[model samples]
Target: MLQSLVPLLVDGLANAALIFFVAVGLTLVFSVLRILNVAHGSFYSIGAYAAASIGLWIVSSGFSPYLTFPALLLSAALVAALFGPLVERTLVRWTYGKSEAVQILVTFGLFLILEDLQRMVFGVQSLYEDTPMALLGITEIGGIVYLNYQLLLIGLAAVVIIGLRLLIRHTRHGKFLAAVVADREVSQTLGIDTNRVFIMAFALGVFLAALGGALATPTSGVAPGLGAETVVLAFAVAAIGGLGQIEGAAIAAVIVGLARVLAIYYAPALDAVAPYLVMLVVLLIRPYGLFGSVTTRRI
Candidate 1:
């Protein structure tokens, strides 16, 4: 049991890393915009499609398989760079200072539009490119074989956590973001361009979500409904971690990840509900979430 558990934990973290990106993006957008953007998941699928396409292209063109890694990041950057500001400027901007219902509705519409656009561009067929994963090969840990790519994801997640902390705690932009979070009106009065900040943060959120999808593409198929599934899990992670809590997202991702892997390992029937069940329990125990505080949004 002890040996079995180590592989389970490692697998859980690997799954959690991808989920963390989408959840953290959602949480970050909510923390700053004070609105839940329902369409954030669209970016995830878009990223996956982009990555898979690029990866396949690289392979078909007889390019170095090593390019797959950069292709993943580039795919995400392309999505964010192209659609992020457009979504914010046209749709999200309208939701500013609006009721939660209105915000959700607007983003949901955008989500539908983007979803259809993706189908039109990439078709309904599922797509995947695993050269990146194959190239990295596998490693045996504690007698259990694990993908080296999986371990890389864990390391990447750690770096993201540290990078985000430094961005929030030590940068000038971080101070502005904090100011806006603490008191929007005061920050506006203090000469901070809230609109610019909003755009940047939303773009960052898009990038993160896209990156998650991109990274997962080598191992997972990109399907039409992938975004919807991803968004739902991201929501669970965000909720369990406490809305707007970055660290909370990390912890919640691990908790959710562990629950998922454990369920898959033991009671396969419970795999689907595991994350939400955990979320329900966490929220029931701590309304503000594990890392969330009632006073401030921290994601």
Candidate 2:
């Protein structure tokens, strides 16, 4: 029993770790900006492409293979820095005070644009870079061999959860974000620069999404349509957890991850739909999500 379960648990947690980054970032942006960014997954793909490209370049250029580890983080940061403020200020800000339809339409259009951009820039071929994974090697647990990089991802996810909690509960910027989430108008009235907050929040969201992609690049292939697939999973996660709940997102990611793994193990044909199935059941029961509730919105 332990032998059979160990692989399942390890794979599930590893899957959840990547999903958590994207889901939490999506939830965070929605919590702050009150907008669901359909284009958020584009950043993820871009980051993967960047990381793989950078890692490949480093190896080809006679650089140490270990540099690939830092390259993952650097790729995420670069993607966020380049596109975060740009998208938030121009496209996202325009959708503010607008209808949900308008927001969705605008973001979807942005998603299309980014998708095309990715195809044009990165081409349609799948890219793979696994230097970091190779460097870390593997570990044996429960009589099973598992990639150490996978375990590292699980640890990283836990650290992110704790780090985010601390950031929100103990940091000054977190206070501002909390205030804004509580009452945007009141936050502005209290002299908080809501615009700045929005920019930072969006950028952070991009960073998280990109980081997920970058980390996953070592274990998976980066292809043109990866963003579309990831965004759907992200939306399922966000919905299952409640759109704006951070803790909800974390829990939802685990559920979705486990669902996917289980499906792969037991019913390979249902692998793709497992997460959505869980989302459907959860939504049918809770409607507002596990961690979400009915609250009055202030215009």
User: In model 2, which runs have C-alpha deviations exceeding 4 angstroms?
Assistant: none
Best by TM-score: 2
> What TM-scores do the predictions have?
0.97, 0.98
Every model: Cα RMSD to truth: 2.2, 0.9
The lDDT, on a scale of 0 to 1, for candidate 2 is 0.94
